[model samples]
Target: MAEFKIVLSDRETGRSYKIDATGPAAGALIGRRIGEEIEGGVLGFAGYRIRITGASDRTGIPARRDLPGPARRRLLLSRGVGFHPVREGERRRKSVRGNEISADIVQVNAVVTQRGSKPLDEYFNRPEAAAE
Candidate 1:
């Protein structure tokens, strides 16, 4: 199951709460201090939901997935054949450095991790799915 981050803050006392994303209702019960009114609970920077409540018992939370973005892209780029600028007048091009790197990763994983074949498109004519 996916995890979410949650942040709770009291409007009256300025107290704050940070917790891993779970059922908001459950966390609200866990994170709220006794007799305190819940003001807000929201998702934290990594996209986990925050829940504010009136009870307090902050403690261990589970690990969360951190999706790779620009910094990771750069690190990945550096480890393989580098990316190239998209030149004007070019309609299409070779696999991106990331793509190249991914292919390499697939090859390596297949060998070392004993994973199965990385699925490749059997045909290019299929329509792309809209972003959900």
Candidate 2:
């Protein structure tokens, strides 16, 4: 069975939430590419909508939107998702995962598109229990 750690970003509040998806929720995410939108019910949040923004494989290779499949490839780039430029006209081969999600992906990044009737703070803003 596949497992995924979903990082949901709430742009309005500039806050993020982390949830672990297992069983059916994990299965539903497999094969979904970046930029695709899925219902929040899939992640146990009914009435909310989330859009996949990016994902990373087990080893932390970020999925690039311009790339097509689930395979990892090294591409020469001056500056982009995987590569960062330090000097002028610098380019190097950097490994990056494709846009598609697969079993190898361990983390998925997403942004909330539609909010449910209840505000998100109600869900994630619970106060921490005090330590005795």
Candidate 3:
């Protein structure tokens, strides 16, 4: 039973969540393409879904190049890419081991695609939920 640290970030909000997951389910997340959706319950939440956007190893180097500018900046900044913080909450800080995570630790970047009864509806009045 190995535990892997995962960081899930909300695209709309600049907030990131650190979830510690174990077992084969967490392992399956590796290599999944961006835009793929996963159950949020796996990260200990319900009524929510996560869409994978990017991932990185212990060193904080991105696994993909298509990440949005803000997302990339957040990841790098969390890994201490810039000057040291002068105060608390200066930059986005990850709760997981800072740059020293195990090789199996995959920091995942994701956005909440669904919450409660509402799926993220980009199209106004389309009501795509009925098709699901």
Candidate 4:
């Protein structure tokens, strides 16, 4: 089964929570892409909604939204997700994963788009069986 370390960022609190997803929960994330919205119920957030922001593969390559598929590619870039230019008009070829989520992905980054009745602080503070 595919497993992923999910980091959920709360815009209001400016705080982030870490959760592990595996089995069915992990299965729900497959084929999802950056900038896509997902139901919170899939990740056990119930009423809350999550938006995919970014992801990293097992090899630590960051996924780019502009890319089309789930394969890694070396692209010449001016400035973007995986590459940061120091000088003016500087560009370099860098390896970045495609937007699509796959089993090779190790980490998933998201932001809460909708608020549930309960605050995330109270939710995360409660100890529960997190995916291992």
Per-prediction TM-score to the true structure, in the order listed: 0.19, 0.92, 0.49, 0.92
lDDT order, best first, reads: 4, 2, 3, 1
List where candidate 3 sits over 4 angstroms from the true fold: 1-3, 11-14, 65-105, 117-132
| Backbone clashes under 3 angstroms, per model | 14, 0, 0, 0
Model 1 accuracy (lDDT, Cα): 0.25
Q: Which stretches of candidate 1 lie over 4 Å from their true place?
A: 23-132
Q: Kindly report which residue stretches of model 4 are placed more than 4 angstroms away from their true locations once superposed.
A: 126-132
| Candidates by TM-score, descending order | 4, 2, 3, 1
Indicate the TM-score of model 2.
0.92
Which candidate number maximizes lDDT? Answer: 4
Q: Kindly report the root-mean-square deviation of model 4 from the true structure over all alpha carbons.
A: 4.4
lDDT of 2 by residue, 1-114 (tens): 999999999998798999899999999999899999999988888899999999998898899999999999989878879888999999998999999999999999999999
Native-to-model Cα distance after best TM-score fit, residue 24 in candidate 3, in Å:
4.0
Worst 10 residues of 3 by lDDT: 93-102
Model 2 lDDT at residue 40: 91
lDDT of 1 by residue, 19-132 (tens): 454455334333232222332222222322222121111222111112121112312222212333466443422222121111112111000111113211111122341221
Per residue, candidate 4 scores C-alpha lDDT tens digits across 57-76 of 98899999999899999999
What lDDT score is found at residue 30 in candidate 2?
A: 93
